[model samples]
Target chain A: MKTTQHKIPTARPSGQRPSGAVVKPVGARPVIGGASSDRVIEFRGVTKLYDGGDIGLDHATFGVEQGEFVFLVGHTGSGKSTIMRLLIKEVQASSGVVNVAGHDLAEIKRKKVPYYRRNIGVVWQDFKLLPNRTVYNNVAYALLVTGHSRKQIREKVPDILRLTGLSTKLHNYPDQLSGGEQQRVSIARAFVNHPPLLLCDEPTGNLDPETSIGIMQLLYRINKTGTTVVVATHDHAMVDKMRRRVIELSAGRIIRDEAAGLYSRDESTREFAVRMRGARLGQPEDS
Target chain B: MRFTFFFREALRSLKRNAMPSFAAMVTVLVTILVLGVFIPIVQATTGAADEIRGKLLIDVYLRTDAKPADVARVRTLLADKTPNVKSVQFVSKEAAYAREKARFPDQYELLGKTNPLPDTFRVTPINPDKISEIRNSLLPVAGGGTVAVDPAIEEVKNRRDQTAKILEATNFIKITMALLASLLALASVLLIANTIRLSLFARRREIEVMKLVGATDSFIRWPFIIEAIIVGGLGALMAISLLAVGKVAILDPFAETFALIAAPETLNFGLLIAILLAAAIGVSAAGSTLSLRRFLRV
Candidate 1:
């Protein structure tokens, strides 16, 4: 196997970790019709009405600027997945505009939607790796879709694999790997394109808290490279500890948009605070 | 490079989804096999029926006083105007009398100088099923005995008792073969189409992964199309090979031993195989591409 000379991304200290800086009010109306929208993702009065008149998202609006790490924290059926689906163009907005990476989702033709999606990478809780493909091929598949040269894939795949800490398991198929390793491969595939935006739908939902942190750290490192990351997860403790922007949804509505948000204000208990304190002490969070 | 990648991916999936792939292959094989074996049989049987049909001769007797102009008009109507009449042979009363005299001199001599055989027009139709059509056109529209509506034709005579049985039998054979061949083909196509659909459902997650990873729709679709082609092609080839062996080893011997009345032209084996291959592959590819629409709705 060929080795990548590209340096592997290292772990970040707690203090230096990236977080969302700008705080916006809940349900803020997105400014429309700018020549160059710095917002990597913008949802303006977005609503997703599914078949039989069921609403997936109800006039929800939010924006994430370039290079922001935001967590989408919501319960099951709270319409968090709908936002990710809209951003990725998996589902269309029923009555609003969705702009991702400055391309309006509604404007993309069906034939050109694939090219439009190339700018955004998506991950799901299931890790969604090709079951029969090796980790290397799974990651390389992203670049392959864009018609990259063999040399480019050979170089880029290993670098992303190394960054995701899967260099040793390049040839391992998804089912052969642990849940965390599979999730890492999934992330590697999603990040290999170095897309401007990455959307994760409960990416670490199946992994233990420890493995979930490892996956999150890998995402963090990618986010540090200036890729805007949107993680839709219900991992409240992990979101609380990271202190990134949390966009919480309830009943198809934006209930909270907090800068340096906890998973929930109610989750900011004394026990959780002690855990954070211990996490800050010599017992490292990176491990 | 893209082609090679798609082919490799197809091959890998073929191995991974061995059961569904096998079922698809088997379905194609059975469809082609049924078609291959039955088509030539139908063709051969129909050819024989056509041969028997070619011999149906309709004899139309003309009035003894028919004018030359009337005879010419009747010939023109039967020869140029009719749809099914292949050829019209004119035999005058003297010519008909001479033919009968050559066969039996005493009976004709008993007739003495009087010749009872009228000037006849012998009509050969294109097909046996067409005999009734040709006969119908010659009959009087007023509907009586089998006399022509034309003034020249005294009576239109066919050996209805003997010819009716042959025409009915041949017609039944042709109709049954045609119906059976079409039904088999339709059944085969539906079977493979369903098989491809089921396989797609099984591998839907694979499609989901490919789409989310920024793969274009065409990029995601190529491997599946290639896979279907392989399955369809392999199945058709297998069935064809079996048919070829059966033709050489079994059918050839039986065809020779029977000493059939006429050597009939059946469907060309090469053309049949080509058609089967094309149909199998086309259906497989079409099925996969169409079924893919539901899952690709991103």
Candidate 2:
């Protein structure tokens, strides 16, 4: 386990500490062995079957720790996208427990879904930017949803735009921007509210290799700033470059789990290669 | 902030779809104008009928045996005692006989043997509405000298009451027309709202994306609702103006034909206020209800 150097402070006052108090420094990672206690997402025996009885995910069990950048790599029909959907409560799990940001996916009220989404950011391959709205408004939308005042929005929007390298295109509409620029605007929009979790569903899928690499670098930078990042893709090259923790799925099952894996290998090593390549490069070699 | 955004968006959308908005406005205007013209005429006729009812009068006849001094005393008593009596004229037996002979010339030859008519006091009430009460009050004063009211005057009052009733029925028809007009206006609003909804549905993907990014449902609906309101308001305004012009151009000339009976000046500020209020309420209610139900889906 790679330990974060920061020390965690006591959760309660020392004078009022009960007999069971576990003393720790301020900012220390809340980890037991290699697993962190502050998991942002959890899936316990989760299953999702489509309307026609086709299985989307079959008894998936996993956990994503807070502020941890995790890659979810799988082939087509392997349930990577299903996991992402379930995490955001876009689709309910068929059975078992699925929790994200302290809300149970199965029991969360429909009206509260928007509030739930406020704690998470979603970036898409298509950018999903309104062609009529400028880049600034697109990013400002996230903050607006969280009921941020106009003054706060005005102050925060410019800073996020600058951070996402979209300051120059603040006045530009989606139609006027290139694919890469649109993705940047999307990223800015996703992160403007400073959500604790950021889910990118093939964020670099539509871009060329250079653009894909740039977007991957941007995601890498975002992940380092303590925002939990989950990228669902079959992208191999970008994944290998980042060399992050990888969870590979096959036939709706987590077939391989590797730490610091590479992009390519022989038939037996295909799992690690695919997972690593997808994580770092954001595109599988075959895809 | 939401309303501001909605207003801006609605205004922008209206500008963008100028032709359709103009069409909607015109539809609203025409409907409201029709109502404006139809309502006032009905109201004026009702007013005139009421005026006639309040100004009706009756006459009373005295017995032939009654002396001239008795007739004079009766007249003075009626003038002083009756609250409603404006004045009383003593028609002499000779004058009554002359009037009867003039009314029926063939009967005058039979009456030549003896004057069969009695003297009478033609009593006019200050207010026609008080005629019934005045007649009821004067009945007990008929002593040995018989007091008789004119049958012709009673017939005229009955005719006026019937006319007033008919005029009031016309008011009912006018109200029915207003109701029908309002219903039609509501239908128009629904149609316009459906049109806006269709436009919004065309951009469903954009809306979904907006939702995914945390835009509230109200934020999504504001622009469409605002657009409907603007369209409805403009339509109502146009209808009012057209109605005013039509009243001036068409109603004024039509009223001149019945200048003796219909007081054109009766369509005053109160009436105008009533018409404007009805239109404003009708348009606003239709627009808001349709937009909220059809477009907002709330």
Candidate 3:
């Protein structure tokens, strides 16, 4: 799916906190990543310990440069979600530094968290669309929140919906749409603002093989537009087929990171796994 | 954020979470209904009390053999010189006898036409609060003082103890009612807060999605606030409707039952509705704001 380009809202100046944020004088401290426009996300030895003595993440260190489509692959309880949470600043790092879009998240005031989140888009495994809102409203919600003009919302929403292959289902509620279509709505909502970064936590986790591939293709196309897309999923087959930059997590720690990574050594085994999954999805084995 | 968008979202959420919205509305209805009815009843009771107090008067009876000139002078003195006296009316012995006869016809018949009633002046006080002071000023000086004693005046009956007791009772009622109304208002605020908290709890996921979508805390909160206000407003409307119905069906029909007391018109329907609506919206907004503060941290 393709559509005419639309304007994305520009990011706020780094280190300039929004109202209600703990106000610090501008340039109170040197900007964290001065002169580094290409690096979008940087984490240096970030550690996160939950309230009950459980380690959510342990001294994780990584950087995702601009316009890169990276996959974070891990098993359940491997801290994949924690990384996403940290990137979105849902939880703060217990120790060390975490920076997104050149603003140090630790330094970002609590009130400014929403402003920080607007710079990126996020998707979830559950396809968190408002049950009552139509596909159109769901997509427009992204623009509506960032306080876009009604004219901008009217113009931007349809283009993004078309891009996500949901233009035909504009008036359809989430329940009326198929799982794949609902996920498309989620994608449309996530990318409606054309955010600099897109974070998907198991975007295809709830989908069947054919539908999952369609979603991946859509995400791949979105990534081609120079928007950095980071997807955290355990879908080995899709990861293998894509052969993209993959960061692997094990027990709250990154174990393996590759420029172009596969989940396992054997591509045929992954293909068989995908076929079995398709079979369970009621797709013919041959397909 | 667009106002229309917030309004739409609030409406959608209210529909989506029908049970909580209904519960909140019901809470508002009960709370506002209590305040609405309680206020007017208090006003009506105070009016009735004041009417009863207004009728209280002091009677100065003359001696049986008193000269007419002395009676006339005393009446003039009460009317013109008494500090808090509102008005004075002289009732001759014949008029007094006629009034007594009208009041107790059988007793007058047993008296065999003898006019035993005394001539008196009824003194009405301008300020009920200064009744004691007026009574003290009117008492005849008995010994060793230059204060002139009108010997022809037999008794000064001001009903001081009775008036004090009545005023005390009315004040007690007023204070008790005010205290009760304040307690109910406090309870209403707490109930509203609890209901809004529950509604917000059910919509916590929606709030999470909103936050993820880059909504500022205010953007995420405004819909819930507006929804709460609407629920409160509906509750107020319902309460006002109920009050209007009650006024027509209960209060107006029974007006004769309270004919002895002046009707207090303080609870005008239009003014009461305006006040109730403002209170409903204000309280709901306050409750929602308090509850949303904890949840909108995302």
Candidate 4:
């Protein structure tokens, strides 16, 4: 008999609780406290200003819990990309602290950046795949950069390609593949290392609606596993269809933070829930 | 494993960027070859000067009327008193006449009738500088018996001194040339390093991508350094080959044309090895240093 240990909420005793409390605390919701395996990214009053004297990020403080999916929605130049760059240590903040996966960004040594980044994966809007390399090599490159052995690379690359729905296009170059397939290859590269955190910056920006929904479903499936996902994009339709926690930014400031919310502002022109459901159904459940 | 990965990458990059690597190699080769030529010339000049000083000898002539006892006394005196006198050979009057006749076969007919020449004692000095010492030691012992030092030995000493001075001037020129060659070689390394750095800069996005995926600094830098080393090594090899061929085909014949200076023979195996090693090491050091600078910075 495999009995699950349910953590009991250790708040004020039921008898000592205040009278007018309408919300019942569900057994602490397994807070997932910083265990050795837990991965959490936190920003404490992080601010970034460009050398040209424009504020890129403004005193943003937030934390993404382990195994959670969150959307970072903002207009152009609204500091969404800035926050992503700070997490990767690609850009330094003007002030305040940034801690990603237990590594402090402020005092992180330059030599450790590669190691720091290895714990996280990144996908770009343009797919950022090497045009010269084949689909198989493109995905394998991530492992290669980490100095993985050839045997591991040979074993892991095919598995990742299969996971990304790119198993059949292994020999094709970026130019030979469709835009969606290229983006899938890029996604495969990001996930090949099995990084705990995956940051996607406008991954579906160039994709058509059908392909965009497919890409979103792929991300959704990946999020279901244990990886924390932070998606920075202006694609309101995809955000609305996912119906996840949305942190909306406006002019370097967080204006809205909604739990299990859909895109409700002016940018919410297209509804993708129906297409997203269809795409989700298209993939085999076991995969 | 790390080094192997980097080396592979470096070889791949070199293949991809063939033109720039080739240019860098040629630049290094030319500089090394020029330096190679100058090194031997400098060594040979110094060697020739030393050889000339060692070979110069002074001869003391005896008067025709001098007694055989006086001649024997002079020989014994030179052997005992002069530290500079390496050896003393007493030339009998008959032997002296025969030597004069050998020098001028046509003049020997007149020499038989006139008896113009005198017997001589050839004093071979341990060094050219000791020629004067031997002359001074013998002058008084001759007792105004017409003791004449061979003018040719004096001429040899003057010529040797002049040759040493000329060699000094040439050595100065060689030093300057060597310095210039070194500077040129350094410039070539810098150019190659900068060119590779610029190429890396252009592919910074690729580097960023690699970095994001956990590429170590060693992994990233190894390829660049290997590429630089390959370029430098190939350049040095080409330069040495050129030097070897030039030394044999060109410099050897030129040396033969002026065989009296002994320049060609002075360029021996030991000197060639020194020049080749210097060039190879110089180019390799320059390339490796430049490449390591960037990696060490991070």
Candidate 5:
């Protein structure tokens, strides 16, 4: 396995972290539990069948503990995107319960969906950056809609940008940045409010392999700050290399769930060997 | 969000999408300007019709050879307390001749010597529709019908055709103005709505992004609302100012052409301006809000 890089891009010159900064000791967040608590995400027999008789998710059941990083691996149309939408309450489950950040999604009022979404950050494969706004304003937009004061926005935007290694490109528009840089800007915007749960749907889907590693490392450092992270991707090489908690799906069903699991049943070691050989010989890689 | 933020954003978008915004504003301006000019014209026409209707009256003439007592009885009958009679004015033969000379001096001079006009009573009715009733009561009855003239009465000239013409003209004016008012109102509403829909449709992507970033419906709605209001309000102000200029430059100078009605100064411009501004703001806001409903569902 390739050695994982644990580097934070740069440290602050002042040596004192800002309030609500994610540089605190690990496990500082308490793992609360009982018959009903400590689960950041819970889906019990959740079935989502869209109109026209297509099944989005078929009786999927899983739970993520606080601060856990879970990899959701599947091919295209494997219900990965549906899970992200369901988590954000963008699509309602056809049956069973979906709970996110201690709120039952089924009971959430339509009027309250915006407020509910503020507690959870979401990143998409396309980056979803506003082309009209600069990198700073794109991050500031998250706070702008939530009624944060200008003073608060001014104080928070720069810190988040610096944290996301985007301080130099603050005034640059989305089109002016690289694909990976645009993804980083979206991440900055997502994490600006310090949402406790961050959900990413194929964050590195459009980036090169080298840039993809950088993004994965960034997500890893964020997860270390006690923010629960769930990433849905089809990148088997990255999955096999990282070997984190994996949840595999096929045909809208959860086929396997394991701590430190690979991307698939038996293709882990062979996929890793092929990818490492391709990287060493500077050959074109395939997923 | 801060009010300044919303206001700034609105101004920014208005500037950014200058073409569509200008189109919307111009549409609003034309609508309000048309309304501002015509509404008063309609009101003035209705008022003039009312004035003309009030002046309609019937004239009752008496025979020159009628007895003094008969004349006195006819006068008493004409002046009887009736629900429809508003007032009675008596005119002697000499007075009637003088009125004739005044009205047609050339015709009177050709007649040159003997006074041929008869004494007359001009009767005004409370309701113009009751003119026939007054005429029937004043005319003398024949053996079989009331067509034969009484010895005391020379003629009962009600001028029914002239009254009918006036009434017909007034009704025609009313119907024409009402149709014109409704057509103009509908045109203005449609123009404003179409312009607003285009402006909002051009920026649908921005709204989708806002919604995805967790903006409540109000936050998503307010900037566009403010933008629409600015467009509407600016349009109304421009229209009113243009109308005022037009009145001063054109309508006031050609006052004789519209002599049947009150002057332009008496048109209650302040009220028209207030109403125009309200409508501009109202219709544009409603248009934008309704147009945005489908897009905000993202």
Candidate 6:
């Protein structure tokens, strides 16, 4: 049900170094794909070995290009949220590198974390709406943080609310709205700044089936605006319905990565496992 | 940055974290209360001590047959020997007896016409601290075991026991008062820091939301700063009112009970108000910043 998005905020985790990562040469970044500079999210052998010897992620490497809509479908604890956490700098990679929007996440200083995070919008299973604030103020809060003028915030908040289908509920508090409507306010808040990347962790996990489809459609429409959207979900039916690029994870490793694939692939194709490393040039070679 | 937004959010935050806010406010109330009371007491104590020091005197009784020239020479001698003696006055035998008779009329009546009291020299020191040195210089010193005496002097009394007791008591009062004020102020700071931590803990959810929304550290800090001010200011204002009520009700009614030996100069009412207002804003700002820097991380 509701999973990974709830996990990302147990942040600043104690991560021991994963035992078996190849140390790269100094001044040389491991370019997973030869032309990987344009990728909005890049992970090169990233691992997160949490405290108490539990591995959250292990030696995962992949890249998501600009304007791409991707889904990270995994059961709970399959490291779906770990990848998102790495991108958002919520947790440091125990080994290897995670680069988002052309900046190595670990290199961002502690004080500057707020500035770095503002450029990326993040929503989770919990609507995480300020219950006391009205929907308009909640959405306007995102724009306010980035130093938008009151008038500029006035212009932008309503537009984002309309896009999220929350224009009529602007003055309604979170408790006054339905589950899906509350989620929409959070999404509007996340996207109000038009961040370069939008991350959603089980955005529709708590909603009913029909409401979920509507929320998915809102995210689909937002992705059309050239903002890269990454959704981490355990909802097999929704993943199968969308049929977008899916990164499948099981037990902290990327087991299969498929372009426009269903939630699960046949076990018989195990030997033809899709390679995640050098994509965007062509299709699968099974190597 | 909107005022209405600030007020609205501040009210909600105060409600959400009521315990911590109350604890912080109570701590502020008590701190300002200590400040309001401590300064005046300390000032009053120091003033009383100064008054007591000014009244201390040394008495040197002279040989009754000693000439006025001998008394004058003795005065010059004391002035030269001890830089501490501020002034010296001679009381003639008749005058000494008259003053004594005024104090103990029954004893003087029994003695009839025979005046047994000696002519005396009363010496005042520049300060209480110099009483012993000036007294010693007025009499003869012993080089050997033999106690040599000044020829013009009959007996010398410096009121050494009385002087020692008063100096010790006043000094003790001043030192204890200073120590207590300092310790209370220090305790207040520590209490403020601790209560702020509790307040920040209750604020964790808001902080997490702000951080996720990509608020600048200052932006995230703004709402908390506002809450602390509102709460801390309320506490301080209540303390001021309590003090005003206390001045009229307790201190005024029982003025004699708490009266010092001498109620010396004290903290003016206007100064106390100014200090309390400044402390309210300043301490709340500091308390929030101190706790927020550590506990505000998402």
The per-model DockQ list reads 0.55, 0.34, 0.53, 0.38, 0.44, 0.45
Off by over 4 Å in 2: A1-36, A50-54, A75-78, A240-242, A249-287, B1-183, B222-224, B258-298
CAPRI-style grade of the A/B interface in model 3? medium
Candidate number of the best lDDT: 1
Residue-wise lDDT of candidate 2 within B129-162, one digit each (tens)? 4566666666534677534342212111224466
Model 1 residue A208 CA deviation (Å) reads: 1.2
Tens-place lDDT per residue, model 4, A57-133, is 87665557677778899999998999888888888999866777766787888888887887888988988887656
Clashing pairs in 3: none
User: Higher-DockQ candidate among 3 and 4?
Assistant: 3
Chain B, candidate 5: TM-score: 0.68
Give the winner by TM-score: 1 or 6.
1
When only the first chain is scored, the TM-scores of the models are 0.83, 0.78, 0.79, 0.80, 0.79, 0.79
Candidate 6 C-alpha error for residue B227, in Å = 2.5
Give the candidates in order of lDDT, highest first: 1, 5, 3, 6, 4, 2
Ranking, TM-score, top scorer first: 1, 5, 6, 3, 4, 2
> Which pairs, if any, clash in model 5?
none
Q: Native contact fraction of candidate 1? A: 0.72
- Model 6 lDDT per residue over A150-228, tens place: 8999999999998877879989889999999999998998898889899998898899976776677777767778899
| lDDT of model 5 at position A50 | 95
* Prediction 6 global C-alpha lDDT: 0.76
lDDT of 2 by residue, A1-287 (tens): 33111121211112221211121211122233422357687666678898998788876666676766678888878888888888877788888678776556778776777778788889988998876667988787777668788899999999988887878888887999999999989998898888899999989889987677667767766776889999988886676555666667777776654443332213222343344345565544431
Q: Rank the candidates by DockQ, best first.
A: 1, 3, 6, 5, 4, 2
- Greater lDDT among 1 and 2 belongs to 1
DockQ, candidate no. 4: 0.38
Interface RMSD of 3: 1.2
Residues B171-214 of candidate 5 have per-residue lDDT tens digits of: 89989999999999999998899888877787787787777778
Model 2 chain A worst lDDT run, 10 consecutive residues: A4-13
Chain B TM-score, one value per candidate, order as shown: 0.81, 0.51, 0.69, 0.55, 0.68, 0.66
Candidate 3 lDDT at B158 equals 70
Question: Local distance difference test, per candidate?
Answer: 0.80, 0.66, 0.78, 0.68, 0.79, 0.76
Candidate 3 lDDT (Cα, 0 to 1): 0.78
